[model samples]
Target: MNGYRKLPTAVNYQFAEDLYSVFKTFGLDLDRLSYSSQTGQMKKLIEELETPDNLQKISQLSLDADFADMKTKHEAFETIFADQAGANADLRQMTSATAIRKILEKNLKTYFNLLTVMKEVAGWELLYSDTNELVKAAKNSEIKRKDENPS
Candidate 1:
């Protein structure tokens, strides 16, 4: 995509620094990641399982079916929505059917919004360049700029 522009050596370094700043704003502290060779294997296991496109499939399945296969997923969703309810004092007190539905709706929307952000960040790739600094800069830039405007 045009988002991945080929930058020169100097520009790439500057961009890397700026990218670090952007990641900080979004709560991604890339500097905290381990660069040791052994850390790579461990990091792979901790990564998210789905791409943005596949998330819709996960959302389509819900608490509507309390099947044995769906039991774990249903319980996880229940826990998340309950946490959402606990996040707000007004929601914590509500037991009315209408209020509960609204809270669940809000929870779903918030969950989907989070998925979208994760998807946006995960879809890009980092192309290699002759200069190590340039390639390093490119990778750093990616952590912040899944798009020019993350907001």
Candidate 2:
């Protein structure tokens, strides 16, 4: 009820604040949520804040947008790990087996932890497998191709 009165305007402001808070907590620069950019979804959100019904719809849109933003960040983190693994190819050749194992184990654990956090926040598994068999197959594939294969 509190957020439903002013309708879209209130919802927009709440969403903007929520996004800003998320960015701040994550140490991301607030400018990344720029309102002026054509690609910025927040601009569309503000525009959608004209009426109560519109605000209710916009609130759902904002949640979808937040989920998308989180997914993007998760992908970027994956890309960084992939890039690092690619760059360290020479290390694989030079380092001892124990050293390489330690490095990989640490990185894999970190990546898994990140994925867990993402899953918890999004309230769903990030992996697309709808069935257990598909999930097992995907996991097997990942294990088989453990080395970083840069895209």
Candidate 3:
């Protein structure tokens, strides 16, 4: 897989850092994971699996501002919509089912987008783990075959 082979620790670090920065920019701490620490850990882990040469190349790519902006917007929307039950207290007092439904529909979209982003992140993590396992298995099999053939 080209994506797996080209995976660079530096790029991963920049991605994590940019994601953190975007969240901070929107005044959301997220409170799930520490970005810098996670980046450092990912760097070390990738270094163990990938070649030094490819690692250097990946580190050179700059952090993508557009991606960061999209993430920031998404987080901002999430923060606002997450407090919907509280936010719509006034609307609820008005007792209009139509208005409440509209608000809920909007909030639901934001919530769905948040879930999509989370799912993408999870998919990437799974892909990385699977790739690492496949690589290890290939290496082990090659070694075993060599032992059998005495080559």
For each candidate, what TM-score against the reference? 0.19, 0.28, 0.21
Please provide, for model 1 over 61-108, each residue's C-alpha lDDT reduced to its tens digit, 9 standing for 90 to 100. Answer: 321232333345535655765576567768557698988899998996
User: For model 1, what is the error of residue 135's alpha carbon versus the real structure, in angstroms, after optimal superposition?
Assistant: 38
Candidate with maximal lDDT: 2
Candidate 3, residue 24: CA error in Å?
21
Name the regions of candidate 3 deviating beyond 4 angstroms: 1-59, 82-87, 94-151
Runs in model 1 deviating more than 4 A are: 1-94, 123-151
Which scores greater on TM-score, model 1 or model 2?
Answer: 2
How would you order the candidates by lDDT, starting with the best?
Answer: 2, 3, 1
- Model 1 TM: 0.19
Better of 1 and 3 by lDDT: 3
Ranking by TM-score: 2, 3, 1
Q: What is candidate 2's CA lDDT for residue 51?
A: 47
Backbone clash pairs for candidate 3 read: none
True-vs-predicted CA distance for residue 81, candidate 2, Å: 2.5
Q: lDDT score, residue 107, model 2?
A: 90
Query: What does candidate 2's lDDT look like per residue over 1-151, in tens digits?
Result: 2344336566356555544443344334434643224224433434334346544544654555654574576457557756886788867778698888999989967866666566646544644223435647988899778766655
Better of 2 and 3 by TM-score: 2
